[model samples]
Target chain A: EAGVTQSPRYAVLQEGQAVSFWCDPISGHDTLYWYQQPRDQGPQLLVYFRDEAVIDNSQLPSDRFSAVRPKGTNSTLKIQSAKQGDTATYLCASRGQGSNERLFFGHGTKLSVL
Target chain B: GDQVKQSPSALSLQEGTNSALRCNFSIATTTVQWFLQNPRGSLMNLFYLVPGTKENGRLKSTFNSKESYSTLHIRDAQLEDSGTYFCAAERASSFSKLVFGQGTSLSVVP
Candidate 1:
């Protein structure tokens, strides 16, 4: 089975610039999640969606960060105005519909804001 | 609603040795998962547990919900085992929403 796929692999932007990360989840998976991992740290949940509906996004920075899963299969996360502190890796994961399902993660998009 | 605390922030072990990593939870979770983030930054699922133990090759994991702790034991460690290990928990009633730990960095030397 193909694992989750994330793109651009890496992104470098300047402060105040806008960047978007894209994700393509695995087939037959209904639950998708987005996480941010700072250097030397664990992944932190930013948002999640079940099908085309968002389940939770309380941790997302409403002012600048936005995500959408329009077709329930692919997703896009956008940062309107990047900050230097925004340098980190953005990960996308997907899993089957179950409480104990194991997560399949993508290679992640590493963003660097100068 | 709580968090996971992983122990021994970092560890170095000699190849062919055995080492154990732990995760302590402050929340009331029922399911737990362990992942290894490799040098290239890919999260590899190692084990998923529910208040019991599971073994795969030289890796074993146990989750005790009552005690709110989980452990991962690596036997005959190999150089390929160098990476960061993370444990995540999901609330009993939820649908795979995970609360993750800070992660334990492990390096197996030759």
Candidate 2:
């Protein structure tokens, strides 16, 4: 089976610029998640969706970061007015709706804000 | 606030050796998962447990709910096994949300 797919494996942006990351989750998966991983740190959940409906986004920076999983299959995470500190890897993951399902992660979009 | 603690923050092993990584949780977790983030920024799922044991290849993992801890053992470590190992605790009642540990950085030297 093909794993999750992400676009722009690497991205470089300047402060105050904008960038968008895209993800195509595994087929037959109903749950999608977006995580941010800083250097030398673990992945931190930013948001998640269940069939086009956002399940959680409390950790997301509402002011500049936004995500949408429209059609419940593909997702896009955008950051507006990016800050230097916003540079980090953006990971997308998907899992089945059943219990104890393992998440399949994409290679991730590595963003570097200069 | 739900916390997952991973031990042996950093470790180095020689080829053909073995090592074990652990995670202790303070939350009401119903399941656990182990992942290895390779150098290319890919997370490979190694094991998923629900208070039991599972083994694959040279990797074995055990989750003990009674003790609120989970363990992952890598046998006959190889250069390909060098990476950051992370354990995530999942709460059944929390709608599949996961809390990840800080991760254990492992290095295998030949």
Candidate 3:
């Protein structure tokens, strides 16, 4: 089975620029999640979707960040007018519906804000 | 409040040594997962657990729900094993949405 896939392995943008990251999850997975990893830090949940419906996004910077999984199969996370603090690695992961299912992660997109 | 806490913020070990990384959660975590982010910034799942232990080659992980802690032990550490290790816990109310620890950076030098 193919693991979660993400596009644009690396990105560089100046302040106020915009960037979008795409994710295609594994087949037959129901839960998709987005996490942000700062340099030398753990991955923090930004948002999540369960079959095209957002399950939670309280941690997300909703003002400048948005995510959608329209078909429950693929997802996109967008950052508008990015700031210096927005520079991080965006990681996408997917897992089946279960209490303890393993999550498959994408390689992630490294974003640099200048 | 942070639900998850990790220890040994960083460690350095020589090749052929062993080390353990730990995570403790404050919430009622029913499940735990471990991951390794390599130098290239790839997050790879190492283990997922629910109050038990699982081993794969040189990596072994254990999660004790009752104790609200999890551990990842690396045996015969190698250069490739050096990376940032993160442990995440799923609370009952979160419905599998995991809260992650700060992570432990391990360096195994040959």
Fraction of the reference Cα-Cα interface contacts (below 8 Å) that each candidate reproduces = 0.89, 0.71, 0.83
The docking quality of candidate 1, as DockQ, is 0.85
For model 3, the docking class works out as: high
Cα lDDT tens digits, model 1, B11-44, are 9999999999999998889889999999999999
Q: Which pairs of residues clash in candidate 2, taking residues 3 or more apart in a chain or in different chains? A: none
Candidate 2 chain A weakest lDDT stretch, 10 residues: A95-104
Off by over 4 Å in 3: none
**Which lDDT tens digits does candidate 2 get at residues B23-83?**
9999888999999999887999988788899999999999999899999999999999999
What is the per-residue lDDT of model 1 for residues A1-114, given as tens digits with 9 covering 90 to 100? Answer: 789999999999999999999999999899899999999999999999999999989899999999999989999999999999899999999998764688889999999999
Give one digit per residue, the lDDT tens place, for model 3 in A11-53: 9999999999999999999999999988878889999999989
Best first by TM-score, ranked: 1, 2, 3
Steric overlap count per candidate: 0, 0, 0
lDDT assessment of candidate 2: 0.92
User: Each candidate's lDDT (Cα)?
Assistant: 0.93, 0.92, 0.90
What is the interface root-mean-square deviation of candidate 1?
Answer: 1.0
Candidate 1 off by > 4 Å: none
lDDT agreement of model 1 with the native? 0.93
DockQ scores for all predicted structures: 0.85, 0.80, 0.80
Using Cα atoms with residue i matched to residue i, what is each candidate's TM-score against the true structure?
Answer: 0.97, 0.97, 0.95
User: CA shift at A16, candidate 3, in angstroms?
Assistant: 1.4
